[model samples]
Target: MDDGFIAKPLGRRQIDQAYPLVCAIAPGLGVDQWRAFAAALLGTAPKGSGPGSSGPPAEAGIITVQNALGYMHGLFSYRVEPNLRHGRVLSVDNFVVLDLFDLAGIAETLLRAMDLLARRLGCAAIHTTLPERYLVRDSRRNPIPDCFRTEGHRQETIRFSKDLAVVNDNAPAVAGGLHGVE
Candidate 1:
């Protein structure tokens, strides 16, 4: 069944309505911070100032889907990044859906929005970082990856480690370590 939800780009004037949803996702952040985030994302500056005249250049935007009750149920923030490997890439971040709902549908709708934004911006690929909570526990996680897989994206696990202590002379260096002999 459709949830009677509609998705679209969020604007600066809608911050008051959006803040509660933002708080639902990140309770620790203050309301003032949310206001700043909305401004930064929507690329709005104080009156009489030029674009980005307030601070850093706008690098993100929020896409939100609200239900028939006019309550936002899905929220996703995406940014365009120049990547050496993927040219201009769109990175989806800080995605949140109300816990009581099925996330798969909301996620799909949001990704579709992200894809359109990416295409419009000439992005070559889309990337996102999923938290461990979603990755490990949510039943919705399966469909989440499937959404990307259907679009030809592949998943890879990358691991990195460093020894902070001074190395002992007796320890043999790995092939790419500082002590490696060419």
Candidate 2:
């Protein structure tokens, strides 16, 4: 679960490849823990990533990092274009960032998973309220990790947007419309 791990969607065939990723990190997780994770994931990820996909055996992409201290079981679901008072908003209907091992893993997994979700959903931007060390850093510069301040800076800011327009229209209007937002 070191944030260093890379996560990707797993097809049925590659799920087995996850064993090493799991055991390698939480070496002492035991049968019950594995069973619980398996059960939870089965309930959530039986088919693919989607809202109401399943329950406890939740659904989420697997995180992988060679020699990582732990792995994670992430379950997320969202209401895209959700109806709001005026228009619509993307509400994360179901989202849980869990670290099956050390607490430090929580920081790493949550940060990485959000980063992945923002990009995958074509979100203009993503946001979070976690305090700063929870904020990923770029050598700890003054706002070093502002998520979108520059290339490769996406990991730096917690309260960030994949595309600012999704949250606020006040952003400088783009000529190409929302497509040019990013």
Candidate 3:
């Protein structure tokens, strides 16, 4: 029987073990901050009060994949929400691999695990918010791997930014009275 890649809820030990890999991907994060974030994701509130400290911890999920050597290949975190459009959806917030150049089947395995998790949770869809530059695309214009079909996307919001302090002659002014400075 081919039981899929080993995945389970992240405990404190696993969180500690996984922090270094996470830091490699996202630098400048202190261990304390990572601990707090991991705690929140695991539904274990921190000792102090803060915005995330209150409110029943969101339905968050984290899964880490290990290679044959027992080293981590990648991990992903998501939150489950009741969606009016899709009934229920799993919103993937973080999907990290040690190195994209050498995925070594990690991406495929992890994504399949995510699919199983979504189905187990009764989620109708899986959504992710990756930046445009990081989006993976093949020649066929598929951003996702062939294991799953890609659904077209709709723009949910328009992001606008203005420089309130820069008043240089080269800057342009907009109707909102904010300067557009590079």
Candidate 4:
């Protein structure tokens, strides 16, 4: 079943084609916004220069799962970053899988691909926070966690975030502290 699908790095040329899948995951996102975000992930300039343009580090990219006929069913964006505790870690986000026919297989394939990419990049670990929508405790609609467990991945943390009030960009740094020292 997994053989019918191919997991490949999403290229700059296919950004437009991949937008729909991205929209499925983020409904309110605009086309321009999606294009720019995808371009950054692909390490290509938002306009003019093509796929190989230097933007983000080479270790970061978006991967998509496509069927034999070339339909994108899912995707995830990832970047390798230095971590104080882990040395270097591969962090993935925007994981989406649209093919319900073989959700388990697709999820497994994506996870395996991430593991291989992490190893290739010499990462100490692979970290990803499944989107909040996927954590609703409904097993019927979410099988990704099960796939992760089957692949030997354990849930190490539950993340919590509280949005801070916006701060002025030109606000003066506080005096006599590390905030302004750097």
Candidate 5:
């Protein structure tokens, strides 16, 4: 939404520019993934280009760059991954620069990214980490993103999840009463 900053997928060339920003974010992501990240962004950056323009888009991807006021303001890197529980969920893998003081178009841009990515991935849910302040509207309820919101959208509430052992259909499995195993 920034006047000049465009949010597009990370291409080889752009990825090189994004590495320092990403490293500034989650250093654990390492160097190699950053290289591949650039490769992935090329195909995903919006072009309105489709069949007539080229071919089907590439694999899972992330949105990069935020342009505002004719200069690059920040970067928002996001990706969707399998959630085994309710399905896939979006992660705002990186939220760097822009303005720690003023969160203007941040929400809108993120929402736009999520909407596109969610539909593209056919995901069941969208998710992301929000700062505590802007998250709370009027110092009350937490507003995640105008484009998206949690079920309760409470300040302190969190969605709980569990990882269950995936069992084969033919394998019989059961949870016994307390007396059985003891």
Candidate 6:
């Protein structure tokens, strides 16, 4: 079925257009921050890399799904990294889909694209974790998990995280010294 939707690597020209879609999932990220991050992911102009540089790491990039009208509906950033257990693996993050009406189709398309990308990169496996905010408490009511399962992906591990309190760097240093240490 031709839904007039296509998935392709995000280009430097569409960074602004894709920013809104990214904000839909990452609400706290600012435009300037996202611009730099996207630039790095796109391997166009990584930090400290001069003009005509070789670009960022070859393993990292961002992919976006756009409609026939040239509007971004979803995006995911991925990088191929060496893993202790899986050898070289393709890790996906920041997966965001704004087209709620066709969430399943878009999600599936993105997953398939990741699969192809992983193979092309010679990755041993592909790992993806959906953002917690996008997941529903009711598993049966969530289509994201089903879409992943239908695409031959399995839930292998559960992730646990805790937000650490940020400390002010400008705060006075405590007067303490280790015993017998300079």
Per-model clash counts, in order, read 0, 21, 0, 0, 5, 0
Can you give the TM-score per candidate against the true fold?
0.67, 0.30, 0.61, 0.79, 0.51, 0.79
lDDT (Cα atoms) of all candidates against the true structure: 0.66, 0.41, 0.60, 0.77, 0.51, 0.77
Indicate which candidate wins on lDDT: 4
- Candidate 6 global lDDT: 0.77
What is the C-alpha lDDT profile of model 5 across 1-182, one tens digit per residue?
A: 34444555544456666666666556567778878765665546455421122433233455554564423444655555777765776555455544454344554555565566565656666656553333445745433344244322223346443435444433344566433344
Q: lDDT tens string, model 2, 83-163?
A: 334243333322333344643443344345555555554555443333233345555543223322442433432353364
| Runs with alpha carbons beyond 4 Å of true place in candidate 6 | 44-58, 165-182
Q: List ranges where model 2 is wrong by over 4 Å.
A: 1-4, 10-71, 83-90, 97-101, 124-182
Assess candidate 4 and give its lDDT.
Answer: 0.77
Per-residue lDDT over 1-182 for candidate 1, one digit per residue giving the tens place of the 0 to 100 score:
25576676676678878887767657777889888887787774223221213333234677787777767777777787898888888787777766365666776666666776676667898887654334536444466566656766676544343545555545566777646466
* Model 4 lDDT tens row, 1-182: 47888777787789999888877778878999999898877763233221223322347788778888988888888888898878999899989888768888888778877887777678899998787767756436568787888899898889885534544454456777555566
Cand. 1 TM to true fold: 0.67
- Each candidate's root-mean-square deviation in Å? 8.0, 14.5, 8.3, 5.4, 8.8, 6.0
Counting only residues 3 or more apart in sequence or on different chains, how many pairs clash (N, Cα, C under 3 Å) in candidate 5?
5
Q: Give residue 112's error in model 4 in angstroms.
A: 0.9
Those runs of model 1 whose alpha carbons end farther than 4 Å from true positions after fitting are 1-3, 44-59, 137-153, 157-182
Q: Where is model 5 poorest over a 10-residue stretch in terms of lDDT?
A: 49-58
lDDT of 6 at 41: 77
